[model samples]
Target chain A: SAVISQKPSRDICQRGTSLTIQCQVDSQVTMMFWYRQQPGQSLTLIATANQGSEATYESGFVIDKFPISRPNLTFSTLTVSNMSPEDSSIYLCSVEGGRGSGEQFFGPGTRLTVL
Target chain B: AQSVSQHNHHVILSEAASLELGCNYSYGGTVNLFWYVQYPGQHLQLLLKYFSGDPLVKGIKGFEAEFIKSKFSFNLRKPSVQWSDTAEYFCAVNWGGADGLTFGKGTHLIIQP
Candidate 1:
């Protein structure tokens, strides 16, 4: 297991603005995931960040709207572009220990409110 | 894509009472199941996991879950819950050998002392 930290625990932003959420891990992990959870809703996978390569986005999620960058194994950042009211949610960053059955460690999450 | 469904939206129980949360997934292939607990204002922590070998797995805080492969269900149960057990429980399912998980909507448990 690894310690995951996210910057800006919460933020209030106006519509049409963009915000970047950063996730830092204590150690290197093979797979780093980004998810979005609406208030009282289920978690939705946004993308998988791979070190030294482009991110793999899930269906219905576009790279232009939710761009992800993983410069290395220990760090990744997700930027939400052109925010809207519908974009308000708690964005979480998770790291899996290995491929198959290892437990995942999640960050504290960033609560974003777009008005 | 794999998806999980939690039957209960919220549950309330008195201290020392038994607790069970229903969770079902729609994945035909082999999968890994997990239960996570998130206390108020805290990060999600793993309660238990079922990877292989055993259908019944025990986790921390006296929690256990049975993975019914035939029914595609993994329900969490605690024999006797305490007041401190109040938290949100999420059931997650991961595809075999996959890196990410698909989480249920979550069940809010309130334990009254």
Candidate 2:
């Protein structure tokens, strides 16, 4: 299991402001992912942050609204750009277990509330 | 296009009672199933996972889940409930891709002592 940590555990921001959430992993991983959990809703994959490459986003999400950067193997960042009230959610970062394990270790998650 | 469905939204049980939470997935071909538990103010933890072979898989905290391929269902069960078992349980699936895991709506379980 990987020890993952996210910065800004909880934050309240005004609408139209942007907040960047950071994810740091204890070990080097090839695959890092971002997910969102709205109030009383299930987790939805936002994007896959590839080391040294552009992130691959899901269908409903786009790069403009949620830009991601993965400069190295152990760190990644997801920026919620031009936020709105609807963008308030818990953002989590996860790393896949190595060697085709298919298991993922998740971060504590950044709880963002837009006012 | 894959999706996971959790049958119960909320369940309140007494101590020493049996517990069962149903989960079903809509996907064809090979897939991996997992059960994750999230206690209040804590991050998600993997309870158990079923990749292949045995249909029954045991997890931490004396929780277990069975994966029935024909029914496309992986239901979690516990013989006796404990007050500490109160948490939100989520069922997730991965279909051998880079898309990441798709999760269910989650079932909030409450065990009253």
Candidate 3:
């Protein structure tokens, strides 16, 4: 398993502003996943970031709203643009446990509060 | 639509009491099952997983789950409960591939000391 970390552990932003959350992994990984956990809701996947490719966004989530950049295997960034009150949630980044390892290791989540 | 379901929304128990939380999913393919626990103020951590092999799999902290493919259920169990075990438990499933995990509405477990 790789050690993962997320920057700006928490933040409070205006409804129209944007915030970029960064995820850093201690070791290189193949695929990185971004998830959103709303209050009292299940975790929903936002996108999958693979190095050297365009990020794949899930249904109901668009790249324009959640732009991601995966420069290398060990790092990725998710920017929540044109934020709204509904966008306030915990954003987390994770890596598949490892090759043939089915588990996933997650980073300390980024708590975003849109006011 | 593929979804994971945790039947118990909230569960309360005392120390030394038996524990079991139900989880079921709608997917009908080879899946990788996982149980993750999130303690207060902490990130989600893997408790155990079942890809293949024995239907009964043991995990960390005396936790275990049985993968009953016929019933589309993989329920978590522990012989005894402790206050430290109080946390939100989430069940997840992923078809063997690049698909992202589908998680259940977590079960909140509160163990009284």
- Judged by DockQ, which candidate is best? 1
Lowest lDDT sum, 10 consecutive residues, model 2 chain A, at A96-105
In order, candidate lDDTs are 0.92, 0.94, 0.92
Interface RMSD of 2: 1.5
Summarize candidate 1's per-residue lDDT along A1-115 as a digit string, tens digits.
7899998799999999999999999998878999999987988889988898889998899999999989988999999999999999999999986756746889999999999
lDDT tens string, model 3, B1-113?
88899999999999999999999999888889999999999989999999889999999999999999999999999999889999999999886655578899999999998
In the predicted model 1, the residue pairs found to clash are none
Q: Look at candidate 3 and give me any clashing residue pairs.
A: none
Off by over 4 Å in 2: none
Q: Which is the better candidate, 2 or 3, if ranked by lDDT?
A: 2
What DockQ do the predictions score, one after another? 0.74, 0.69, 0.65
Candidate 3 vs. true structure, TM-score: 0.98
Off by over 4 Å in 1: none
Give the candidate order by descending lDDT.
2, 3, 1
Worst 10 residues of 3 chain B by lDDT: B93-102
Residues A10-98 of candidate 2 have per-residue lDDT tens digits of 99999999999999999999999999999999999999888988999999999999999999999999999999999999999999976
Candidate 2, residues B12-92: lDDT per residue as tens digits?
999999999999999977888899999999999999998889999999999999999999999999999999999999999
Kindly indicate the candidate among 1 and 2 with the higher DockQ.
Answer: 1
